[model samples]
Target: MTTPSAEPRPRFAADAMLGRLARWLRTLGFDTAYDPAVHDPELVALAAAEGRVLLTRDRHLVAHLRPERAGLITDDAPLDQLRQVVAACALAPPPALFSRCPVCNAQLRPATEDEAATLVPAASRALPGPVSRCPGCARVYWEGSHTRRMRQALSRALPGWIS
Candidate 1:
């Protein structure tokens, strides 16, 4: 096994059951890996290989792994799960919204006007704001109602962390 880094930004791999938690983490700009097809052993191995802290609701799996590397989430609610994770890992919210693609877990990049014109929907294009695109999936993102809601949720979850 490889030694974990001391200065590593917290990375995570969530088990199949924690899909919502995984997406929320990605929304917070965390590098979270989630795939329903991954079984427990493979998921644990992947987390170990990638230097990630494994997040799961499976107590059995957690019992099988080193305590330092795995976190078993007890809460059923997504917000509670998020709170548990933040408290457990001592996480700080991302500095910017839409910094990562919630779907593919890829970092988002600024979309050029031309790119936005071609890629963004007509309704979104008409809105006055900057847009970003995911290089992995080419999905366009903007500060729309959904973004505002997510930001609000994060702010509430980690008060004074997100501006």
Candidate 2:
């Protein structure tokens, strides 16, 4: 399969209705901005200031945005919405799965062995793969069965998007 574009991929902001979609985007390492309580005006402004494509289910919100600055979500399911956004935005596959913090939308860094010792659960540290940490929220990440399940979800939802 072909990658998205030569230019940098656009970041995103999802409306409150698309919280799940936002998290999924972050799962694929996209810098997505989402706030469950943000108002339409504020969300629009945030997208504009940050050069983000606003993904929303609200037609009224779509009306206020320039066509390029908005994506109208037409599906109820998160995975379907994800497919639509991925196509509309011409997104590329992520450099690494779980490279971004799904909770805070921050890029995750590889955790030092010392940091992992303190932050990661002993059970998880023993599982395999390196640990990662989100600087924004201090949440730690490690490859575990959950990560494998998430990867499988991605593989099913988006064929050939993740390896």
Candidate 3:
């Protein structure tokens, strides 16, 4: 296995059962694209086309593929699944903050309150500080309790990660 620094951080495409894992990957700042009802062949094809590593739970789906982009998810639970992917991909360190949108798997850009004002929800606008904006989905983000829970959960699942 390649060391963390030596391994290239791969983009990802996750299968149906691994949605939680995909979301967690996005939280960890990986570019993870997830879709439900995607056939194995389609998943593999998407991975190839987009140059993303396929993340899945099915043994057969994970094993038979010849794509340079693939990793078999080893855990059934969300937290464990997240840990498995992180370790398997050798992405032990946290990636740059706000690099990805947690909801739609789009790339996020740093935006000021004025720049992101339209995208920002009224509740969010009235609420707080700087916001991150997803250019593809036009989703606005501000770190909150949900993000904190995700961070804490990830901290527990992957020790020494982002350290």
Task: Provide the TM-score for each candidate, comma-separated.
Answer: 0.89, 0.91, 0.80
lDDT (tens digit, per residue) of candidate 1 on 1-163 = 1224463458899999999999889888889999999889889889889878899998888877653488889999887898899888876566766688999999999999899888888877887678999999989898778887987987887788678
| Alpha-carbon local distance difference test for all models | 0.83, 0.85, 0.75
Number of the candidate with higher TM-score, 2 or 3 = 2
Clashes of 1: 0
Overall local distance difference test of candidate 1: 0.83
TM-score, cand. 3 vs. native: 0.80
Residue 142 CA error for candidate 3 (Å)?
Answer: 0.5
Which segments of candidate 2 are over 4 A away from where they belong?
Answer: 1-6, 64-68
Count of backbone collisions in candidate 2: 0
Write candidate 3's Cα lDDT for 31-139 as tens digits. 8888797888888899889877788778887667765667777778988887777666667576555578877888788777586667666666665545787888877
Deviation (Å) of 21 in candidate 2: 0.6
Q: Positional deviation of 148 in candidate 3, in angstroms?
A: 1.8
Q: Candidate 3: where are CA atoms >4 Å away?
A: 1-7, 64-66, 115-129
Error of 1 at 37 (Å): 0.7
- In model 2, residue pairs whose N, Cα or C atoms come closer than 3 Å (at least 3 residues apart or on different chains), thus clashing, are none
